[model samples]
Target: MERDIGDLTIEIDRTLCIGSGSCVGLASETFEIDEQNLVRFQDETPDIDPERLKEACAVCPVDALRVYDGDEQIVP
Candidate 1:
C-alpha cells in the first residue's frame, strides 16, 4: 500500500512485514498494525514530519516500510 504524506510517499509491503510494531511505536499517528499483524497507514494521519516518517520506516526490522522523496528511496 502507498500514500502521499506531504511531499513524501510512504509504502508498506505487507509481504515483507513481520508485525514487529517498530514502525507503529515510532509513529503511532501515522502507522498502525492491522489484525493480520501488518503495518498500515493510519486513516486520519496528521501532518507527518518527513524525518520522523523516515525514521519509522527505518525501524522496520524486515524493511517492510519504505519512504520515497519523489523517485528516491529514503529509508531501509
Candidate 2:
C-alpha cells in the first residue's frame, strides 16, 4: 500500500524490506512493523512531522522504501 503524508508519498517494498524497524523507530505514530516484519503505515495519510518522516526514510539500510516529496526523492 502507498501512503501520502503532506507533500511526501511513502511506499514500502515488502519483498525487499529487512525488518530494520527504522521507520517505526523514528516515527512511531506513522509507521509500524507487522508480525510478518514488514513495514506498515498507520494510515493512508499518516500524521507525522515531515522532518521525522524524511529522517526515517533516510536510514533504511535496504532500498525497500521510497518517499517522494513532490518530484524530489526523499529516500533512495
Candidate 3:
C-alpha cells in the first residue's frame, strides 16, 4: 500500500499494549503477533478498509493503537 492517506500509519506501543487482541481481532490482516509474541505490524502502512480500521482503533482497550494520515493527521 502506498499510504494514500498521506503519512498514513499505525503504531502499537509495546509498553501500553496488554495483549488483549482487540486490534488483532478487529484487523487481523493488518496486525499480528511475532515469534516473540509481541504485536507487530503486518504492514508498516496497511492497505486498510477505512471504516474497519477506525472500528479497530476505537475498540482497542488500552488506546495503544494509533493511525495517522499523510499529514500525520488522525482520521475519524
TM per candidate comes to 0.95, 0.85, 0.68
Best-performing candidate as measured by lDDT? 1
For candidate 3, the C-alpha RMSD (Å) to the true structure equals 4.0
| lDDT string, candidate 1, 1-76, tens digits | 9999999999899999999998898899999999998888899889978888899999899999888999998887
lDDT of 2: 0.82
Cα misplacement distance, residue 42 of candidate 2 (Å):
1.4
Query: How far is 18's C-alpha from truth in model 2 (Å)?
Result: 0.9
Better of 1 and 2 by lDDT: 1
The TM-score that candidate 1 achieves is 0.95
Return the candidate ranking by TM-score, descending. Answer: 1, 2, 3
TM-score winner between 2 and 3, please give it.
Answer: 2
Query: TM-score of the candidate numbered 2?
Result: 0.85
- lDDT for model 1 comes to 0.90
Model 2 spans with C-alpha error above 4 angstroms: 44-46
- Per-residue CA lDDT of model 3 for 1-76, tens digit only, reads 1223233565567777677777788888777777766666675654678778767866878777777765574633
* Residues forming the 10-long window of minimal summed lDDT in candidate 2: 41-50
Error of 2 at 11 (Å): 1.2
Model 1 clashing residue pairs (backbone): none
